[model samples]
Target chain A: MARAQELAMRDYVQEVSALTMRWVHRLRREKFSMLFTLVQPMLFWLIFFGSLFQRAANSEVMQAPNYMSFLAAGVVVMTVLNNGLSGGVDLLFDKENGFLERLLATPIHRSSVIISRFIFVMTITSLQILVILTVAYFFGVHPATGLLGIAVVLLIGMLFGIGLTALSMAMAFTVKSHGDFFSVLGFLSLPLIFLSSALVPLSAMPTWMSMLARFNPMTWTIDAVRPLILSGWSQALPRIGMVVMLLLVFDALCLYGSTRAFRRAIG
Target chain B: MGRTVAIETLKLAKAFGDVKAIEHLSFQVWEGEIFGLLGPNGAGKSTTLRILLTLLRPTAGHATVFGHDVVQEPDRVRRLIGYVPQERAIDRFLTGREHLLLLGSLYHLPKDETLRRIREILKLVDLEDRADHLAKTYSGGMKRKLDLACGLLPNPKVLFLDEPTLGLDVQSRLRIWDYIRRLKERGITVVMTTNYLDEADHLCDRLAIIDGGRIMALGSPAELKAGLGGDVVSLTVGAADMDRVESLAKSLKAVPSIRAISTKPSGIDIRVESPEKALPAILDAANQQACRLEFIEYHRPRLEDVFIAQTGHAIREEFPSGE
Candidate 1:
């Protein structure tokens, strides 16, 4: 029984931590990519795209102090969405290069592969969101909910990221090549972002567009996050419950799909 | 006589959808010996290795490692095995030491023991000096060494190497071959797959020559080659005529020292008891046949000859000489 218990400890927490650190170590060695991760959202999205509509987008319809502040939340969640979607690129490359086969042959809890991926993606996404929020503060957009609210905002982003990561991993296992995955990403990302309240308020979108955006998990997450940055819990609390419940269902469906995909692919 | 079996497959078969990868393959791996599966690219060598590693389930047979069923008890099977795949399996950004350290934990070695083992393994693979360097900085040979080091982190009882020396320079291939030879000294049973004739001939104590998902022959290299009767003297005739080759073969059969006669695409092969005494007689027969002799050569039987004797085709046909 003692030996049995020793074997039980063989794989979960230990394997996940080691694998997650492996991902972090890879990122650290690639200094150029790490530096770009910090600045890309601020440069491409907040500074340029946010500025395009800053003076034009009405503040009342956006439900924020200004369009840049409203777009700040959108950018954070967009970063999360992008990071989550690309989370499985490493695993796919591993598969193509034969590391995945090597990994699978080892005596590991196979689920640790997925768990480590989740931890790695979330950690990087958190760091990117922090940088984006810091840059937004420089643009005069402090969270109305302050320090505790920022934690809550990060938590909401993470909850939203979990579902996207699972779906992305499913795509990784299902698709034949990274080229196919990128094509799938192009097809999904822009339409989902444009249709949602990320760049424009849902209230301002065409009825047909709004109907589609209502079904997007991204829209639900952005709606929940937009208020936390612009208003306190009192305004954000009601939407938070609905979005959390919605995300739970969304994550369950994605998790189920990805579990099947993973089993089929690995087997 | 009380030898132990390390691995055994009982009429193992596997199919991917409609395509059969392995068919009724049966073999036993004796303990503490280097066993090789020799085959071409699509010959089910990797598939057999994968099934034994418990990475793939066989469609219609059973495989066991140390008496544990691979399909039913993979965790037990896995704990006893390590795999180095065809490619060098390393993350380019991770240092050699980092890869080993992570593998140490992944294999569930205790913290202090993992550190101790890492030190020992780095030294063993001669990576101690470059241990702190990222894998990308390493040469192709160095990357393969790091991969081998990681495979040893678990101290597995049986190690699976799929095409261990593949795609390496001759020097690097020799180095890896040296490493594999030493693995036997450490008493780790090795199961490797390779299509390279020299890799199998020099390294394996015994091997199975497989093709089209079936074993064509199985024995020690010496045993299999010795089964070819005797030395082979191949005469490459300049003509493309099969009838002329057959006629020459018929004429060559009359030579007193010749044991057997066979036809090749470009010439005739005569198995002789001894090439030296038969050389003059065979040359006389060739001279009488009045066919222009392109080239004539004789050598002790090689494993390739054994494969040809069993399967009627050269294994080297898969790879052109340039590759």
Candidate 2:
């Protein structure tokens, strides 16, 4: 029985890896799109846009050593958010192109598709996060809490992204077409970023905006990552624990919603 | 036929809210024979195929693939069957070989075995030369050939093809048909759904004509035509002369050996016991009425005739659209 169970587990793993490789192969084939993904988020935005706000956010009210250092944490978390929110687009395209229908007919665990989507989006997003940090490093941004803090920042980014990515997948299954999904992505991403402390300090923001940003998960993720980059562990550790707890609750809801959508679409 | 039963459905039914996609659907597909579900669009053919593939659950009744219940033992059923849906399911990003490799992994075949079968299937589909090219680079026919190669990856005991040749040019359709026949030769049970009368008549060993979520007629092509017990003599008349066309039909009803007559847009069809004796009287009637005959046609009864006789309408009612 144990051997049989192991075989079954191995089969499930094989199916998931195969499905995941399909997406990776797609990314590999679209060299221009991938190149665009890596270059667009780091070079233009970090150097140009970050410099625009560098001196403005260095005041005591902002409570940061410099704007470039502050925005590094935001950029890392934003990359994760960007990758996670649009992660559903590929699955939506697959649904439109009828590949999802075909996949369901094959002898595979249905969860494999969902799991593979999660792994693919997270891996790509994580790599993009690392790229954002490396590029920011050249710009004189470092994690004040050192190597361990860098790992924590990555962990927080991933934990924060899991729920949003799940929500994006749910949207993929819910929307009628890729056009509708893009609209949904646009509707959520920019608003969430603006409402968070990513671009401007919550202390410097207007009263109403700060009230709204208090509940935004992006703000939570950015705030947790910010200290690791500028203020180090004394200020970052407790925030990390609180952010992880809230994210767990958020991801559970998103996963439940996504599973329902997945079942509804395929069933 | 005293062959092994590969698939069976009893009182199967499915509904989407208030709309009934299929109901009271029952049939048996014998092993080693090509079976067909002949129906028009929305005739529940694809829905039935989906249920057998365990992609959808039936609202009522039971279906089994090689005695494995679709709902209760879906894993086993999936193991025994491979299904090609009515839509094109290829990814333009991947090459032909990549698609099969993915399928192999989904089926959990060993690495060396999958590699070996990929080579054999690529060759069988005549896609060995273009196996490395991206599917976006392949022609419509080549993509369809690759689709067929994917369905054959697991060497399934039963293959369900939903309108396998639904949207292909004549040569491509013919090539797909040839592949389907080859599968049957290898003792693989093929169950396809099509509205193309010629496809069903030419390829299927036995077929069930389904309409409005029900089977209207079920038999071999020859048997169904023979059951009509007559030859269908089609008399063509010009549309400009509608009055003469009705009078022609009215006069033909009095003739002996004529079983039935139905008037159509461009012509009238007469089901007679023998066209040999009925042609003289039909021509005599046309001549008496001075009905200018554009053409006259007679042949052994076709699946269309059987479909018309059973359903009281042409299967081509909606432009031969795919489900």
Candidate 3:
């Protein structure tokens, strides 16, 4: 019995790795998919911040040493979140195009397919964040917390991103249309991004809005990444612990929903 | 399970809401034989194939591929059989070579074997020349050939092809058929579905004709044709003169050996116990009616005649726009 269980575990790992290779192929094959993960978030950061707050670089209200630096951490973490959510759009496309049915017919573990998508989105989004941070570093964005801070930001960002990805995949299975998925995503994304500390200081916001931000996963993520991007790991340890705890809860909920949806789909 | 049958379904049935897609479908395919599921659109041929591949669960009963239950042991069945889905699931962004490699990995072929099979299967499907080009840039025939190559990559013991040449030109269709015959020569059991009567007749060693989610007939091409027990005589009358010809032919049907007469858009088609003995009377009637006879042809019964004899309608009529 023990031998059988060990064999099954090995099989699962093998299947997951095989699926990840295909996910990598899918990511590399489509030029637009890659650009959506990396460049889109940078563009959002440029247009929104450059327009709303022109003196962000010089204002003490920025609180951080450099305004762009403070905002860059938030943008980086947001990129990870959006990238994970947007990964499900590919699953939606697969269903519309009939590829999902084909994949389900194959002999791999069903959950391995979902796990591959998570790993693919996580790895690519992390790389994109690193690229943006490297560019910011060249432009005088200091790393007050250093490499440990950067790693903490990425770990929390990735976990939260995965939770969003699972939720999006659940939506893809339930809502067949790309337009419906986009509309629903739009409904949820903007409010979460704005209500959080992504754009400005939480102290400047009203009490009710601050309460919403505090309750938001994005808010915990920003608080975690901000200190890391500004002062390094020691300054962000307590916030990172809180973000990790919230991420675990969120990931559990999304994963449960996604697995249920997957079973329905295979039917 | 060892030699009695290579594939079998025990009273298999499935439904989608109120629509019964397949009803009590039970059949056995012998080892190393090309078994064809010949049917019109919505006749449950594709549905049966999907179930055998473990893509869908049976509502009742069960199926086995090489003695493994399709429902409970799908991974084992998958390891033994290669399935070419009805739709083109080939990733468009990847090259033909890349697609094969990815599928090979999924099938658990080792790295060296995967690379070797990719090269060999690419050549087998005549895709070697376009192996490096992105699949999105490939022609329809090329993409289909690549799809076939992926199915063949794992060197499966059995292969299932659903409408393998549904959208190909005549040349491409013949190419796929020729490769299929080669696969058969190598002793790979192939189960295929096609609406093309001629394809089923020419390619399948044994076939089942399905209509309205039921198997109306099943046999080899020769055996099925022989079951009709007569000859088919087709007369092409001018569109303007079909009415006179039909009336005359109907009047002659009472004569002995004149089995039946049917009117069609192109002309009048008749089935008789012996066309050689009955042709003179048909010609005589046409002459008496003063109807222009465009053409007359007589031949032994074929798969189409068998389908018509069983269903009382043309298989082509059942699939109005499938082609």
What are the per-model DockQ values? 0.73, 0.78, 0.54
Model 3: per-residue Cα lDDT over A1-267, one tens digit each:
999989777767766777788767766777685687467667568446734565645557767765677788778867876787777987888787766766666667778788888888888888888877887787677678777667766787788888989998999988968999999887888898889888876886888998888888888888888888777666778888888888899999998999899888777
Winner of 2 and 3 under DockQ: 2
Best by lDDT: 2
- Comparing 1 with 2 on DockQ, the higher-scoring candidate is 2
Give me the runs in candidate 2 sitting further than 4 Å from their true place.
B237-242, B265-267, B287-294, B318-323
What TM-score results for chain B in every one of the models? 0.93, 0.93, 0.89
What TM value does model 1 have? 0.94
lDDT of 1 by residue, A1-267 (tens): 998877677556788899899898888788697678545844589988878888898988887778899899889888888888888888888877888877788778999888999999898888788888998899898998998888888898889889999999998999989999999987988887888888888888999999999998888898888888898789899989999999899889989999999998888
Q: For model 2, name the residue pairs that clash.
A: none
lDDT of 2 by residue, A4-84 (tens): 999999999999999999999998999798878654865566778889988766657667777777777777877888888
The candidate, 1 or 2, that scores higher on lDDT is: 2
Q: Once superposed on the true structure, which residue ranges of model 1 sit more than 4 Å away at CA?
A: A1-7, A37-39, B238-244, B254-259, B273-284, B287-295, B318-323
> Which numbered prediction scores highest in DockQ against the true structure?
2
Q: State which candidate, 1 or 3, has the greater TM-score.
A: 1
lDDT of model 2 at residue B285? 95
Best by TM-score: 2
lDDT tens readout by residue for model 1, B1-323: 77799999999999999999999999999999999999888999999999999989899989999999999999899899988888877788889998888887777778899999889888888889999988889998888888888888889889999998888898889889899889899999999999988889999999999999999989899988998788999989885444477777888877888999888688988899988889998878777877778899889998878878887787866555422
The 10 consecutive residues of candidate 1 chain A with the worst lDDT sum are A34-43
Clashes of 3: 4
